[model samples]
Target: MKKTKILILSAMLVSTLFSCQKLVEIKETDLIAGDVALKTITNNEQGIIGAYAAMNVEMGILLNAVFADEVVTADFYNAATVHEWQYTSTDISIRDSYTAFNLYYRIIDRVNRVLAALPTATAANATDEAKRSRLRGEALFLRAFCHFELYRYYSNSAVGTDLAMAYMETPSLQPQARITVAPYFQKLKADLAAAKPLLPTDFSGTNVYRATQAAASALQARTALYLKEWNDAVTFSTEYINAVPLASRANFPGIWTDANSSETAFKLSRTASLGGRIGSLWRATSASASNIGGITWTISQKLWNMYDQANDIRFSSYAKDEPLLVGSGRKYTRLITKYAGTAYGTAAENVADAKVFRTAEMYLIRAEARAENNDLVGAAADLNALRAARINGYTPVVLASKDAAISAIMDERFKELAYEGHRFWDLKRRNLPVVRITADLPQVNAATTLPAGNFRFLLPIPNAEIQANPVIQQNPGYTN
Candidate 1:
């Protein structure tokens, strides 16, 4: 372990330094300091709670908003640099990402602090060994999860190619710290492996809110696929699926709206008026009206028509009719109502706990890995199982070949996991050529296709970080 300095002021220390919103402050006196001022270790339960607290401000909100549909509105061009034609590595999107990144890293730092303090924690009987192990596992899984997501979106990593983005190892307390991509994933993989055995089987015990062993398995499955570990991907995903009670078709959509359902692998359980609400930003509004953040977001027409086919459940899950407000005369396509029944104001009043990892994804991951491994029969069975649960009368798919099985799994992934921030990555992972349909009608507008090497795939490093940290290298094809 590195000997770093630890500063335990009020969390007001962070707010004073960062000028972020008025979030709840973790009491400072409770933290225990070791010899190195750079690190603080605490055996308190609050340390574990603090690890979970890092999810919102640090990463989820910004990543979901930007990656979900992208900033296509005309106003986006003016409000944010990522949308502007003059794209740079040091743009605000990249900069904003630093704060988010720091959030996760901060959690990781705290986890490490707790680990360093573990010897003393154990001696004093301040923590139960089993409970301590479970908490440690949760922290490891979260650290790996956040880093993996950052690698995919920000770093340049092509599907099935060796030229993906570098991964970060330690969360640098300093503003800008550099970590390479390969080593980063290695650390994540190692962390996840360590945590897998220690984590509890029932993470969502009463609230489906925390990470469990199943979540660790699901995450391992995702990371394996990203690293091209096909067999490992299948293994972990299979383990996760085996643990979950498969959902019936009629209960599919409820997985998103009704958090109480068994289908949710892990969720951020935010009761009404409790946590961050994404619905407020996504609710239907007029084209002419400014977006909630002075930037209006609409569902992509191309994404909409993908569901127009018969028996496509996503058509309902991802879309709605746009009246100027809620009930104006003019009609257009609004994003599918993932957050349903709850009004935006009510939803936004409290943060809806973010659903970070779910079981539905493991099924798709298994299907993809099985197809890639030339197990077409196995792949088809998995694909059909997920479909049978969604489509009222889905006919089982018969695969004569691997390619056909792959196609079926991809389609199922599109339907089952659409708008959950997985499609863009799924397409990227498959190395599929993406054609952005920018035409006004959306079904067919501008057929802008980027080859597999298009630089757009690599998110520009947060510009501010690049400027602040000289060691942090800009991803290839983007400017510093």
Candidate 2:
């Protein structure tokens, strides 16, 4: 089967704010109006693909790593303002936050347009009907997924009962009000529920880039785990695990390079010509001088020490002990190979597919849920299952208590899902502290730790967003 051709609209077209901006302003110079673009099944399909393409950018993935303890600046660049936690609403990083906020909302708008057009979209036959339903399901999934991303970055503590993020169900020029955390999650889960039946059990024609029933289940499992719905997390995660098995130790390394891994539930299909420099941001590459992959950031020694380097396949698969040259020819021996671009079969050094969801995460989710529910034995088994697959000469850990089980699960999650954009959010959702040690590294600050309840963990809402939408209040501890 042919790869799904990326059909993204122009950035200016998709980047328009939902409030006080006419939707008609999204039209291109030669293309038809936005409304006409979604009138047919083919057009709606393109629009849905565009929504997926919106997530294909790099900032969201990189910001998560930057905020976490996984990386430190490589001395070639200064991100100290954001990296050292001295950021506010007006910082340059905040501009990237604004762009991410708008990007996800743009995805929501595109999905909403397709959903609105679906009922009356021109379908030629029963095959077209099937296509329409699948498209609708994918759109709904994208809408939920985008909203969840926004909530993770911009919202206050998930445990708090306050306005968090907006749930955009329809396209409108009216200022969208931020809903409270409870209701926002309600809407998020509803979208996934509605989408589940419409999607196929698995993607057809090798299309794991698109949403499948397994993908929806895995996302719902993640959502439930975040919400502390232990039973629901267990149910959905089990459903996903039953459908997709873990990649074996030998096959696991290939998953990073070979985009189409059996372990991946969903990933954003990226080509050298289409995607952003994701791999470059994390790894050092020889592709281009501009693609000095780890010039801005490299893996932290703290994270590197988490694995038993001799026995853990993840240590070898995700990291490299190559010499990193700094000013005056001073060289360091730690680099993160997780996002290196060599795997994408592209000449661009930093080009690699963005992994969205993997079956490995489902096992971790299930383990956490079971541990929370006091099923230590079951949780340990789940954790051991994942470890056995990723670690060489693995030993099945036996946890005798709930706390032990939870800690093991957390450690496994850190090792298993390190650079794939889960570390920071995992720390936040679990209410764990963000601690950075300056030991063995001069690039980072000396022993800075942000407690679990600190206000900075929730990013400051961009000042531009606050200015544009009066109804949207800034996150506390941030000034407009």
Candidate 3:
């Protein structure tokens, strides 16, 4: 099937708050926009590389800007104390998030343009058919991957009977601006399925740095689980995990710190010239030249204490020392240290790939699915494999029942996937209680529940999208 360009309005048209760096720029005159560089076959390869590069520029600031403060409110914001009914009305986060949404759409636009151009380009003719197919598959997988992330945040919860947020399929040029949740998942699933067969089993000769079949499988599993397709979740996740071995315990830390690695399924590539890096931008202390100055977020003391011992390698990997500005107020004895480097300082700006999907996540999914399916023994074994790998001096999992096993799985996911965008979704998906907190406000009761139709869970449809595409309605709660 022919792919449609899904460009939204130009970033220039959006509110001024999100004007960080252009998410997708394709000026032929400037090599960075990925136009002239990707005009030919060899250049097309570079263009693909550049497309992945855009993710770093788009996500680096946004991740720290939105996630650091929003996800772990209990750590810094006293989220547990504030009532969800009373979050900041003028939250800078709203504006920051709007900008991120704009940037991500732009990134998707570029990937679409590349996918569109690839078929007719000279590069398409010169490369072997298999190589070409692999490259195209990587692009599809990536496009689907980004769209999925967009859906999760922009749309409402898909729990019980509620459908997810509307999916954005058409590029900005098309008049059909929004599609419903059912169709959105349909399109995302199709893209993932199409990409699956074309992708290589493992990275080899070419497309090594791009998404492979395993990556696509991993993505399929993720999307499936989000839609609550337990069996499909088990199948695809198993496929992904079986194909790509998990990162050895010793090298786990390196996956977060560096750009290049065999274990990484798909990452946004960064370089000194491109102006993006996860580690340096997220730096806690000024000791590093590339440090972004202030550390915006720190690992929660609660999480830090959860580690079984002082000697666990995973704990040390994420622990860093930095001064903090807020709640339980004190300097962080150890900030999240997984991202450590000056390769992409705030100014020098090296680009790095955002690690989207990895093998470890698959294990977590399998554990969750099995527990949900009432296979307690199967679930415990999967969870234990990872726990043993990350924590030394581990004891065997002891839960004998399914409910106990499931709780263990959630806690394991919290620790394993910490800081990796899963926490917020997990909380929302399970329909857990969310209490917004504050340093200055009155304490909210811990037992306050997230109402069934709470609007905050869904981001108001981006204001810019509403203005440009009149058909795009605001999500249930936010003011247009």
Give the Cα lDDT of each candidate.
Answer: 0.60, 0.78, 0.61
Between prediction 1 and prediction 3, the one with superior TM-score is 1
Model 1, C-alpha of 348: deviation from truth (Å): 5.9
Q: lDDT: which candidate is best?
A: 2
**Could you give candidate 3's per-residue lDDT for residues 1-480 as a string of tens digits?**
123222234444464435533434433443554345445555555656666656633343334223322323323443321223443323444554334466566667766766765675564454544456666776777788778877776663454334444445444565345566777788889989898888777654335457888788888888877777888889998987777677766887776666346355665555556544454444433534433344445555556666665546677666644434234344343455555543323433322445677777898888888888887778888888888778877787766887788678777766776656675566667665443334322234433345544666555665666677776666665565
lDDT of 1 by residue, 1-480 (tens): 122323445455886766544333544576645433322223434576667765653143334334434323422223334332234665665555434445555666766666655444542344464466666677677777777766766653523334333344443455444455566677778989998888777755653677778888888898888777899999999888888866765565556566455666677655544535555444433232333222245555555565534575555655565353354322333544665434443433313446666677888888888888988888888887877766666788788888788877777766666556666556666777555555422223323554565565566666666766776666677875
Q: Each candidate: RMSD to true structure?
A: 9.8, 10.8, 10.9
Query: By the lDDT metric, which is better: model 2 or model 3?
Result: 2
**Comparison by TM-score, 2 against 3, better one:** 2
TM-score of each: 0.78, 0.88, 0.76
Ranking by TM-score: 2, 1, 3
Whole-model lDDT, model 1: 0.60
What TM-score number comes out for model 2?
0.88
Error of 1 at 472 (Å): 2.1
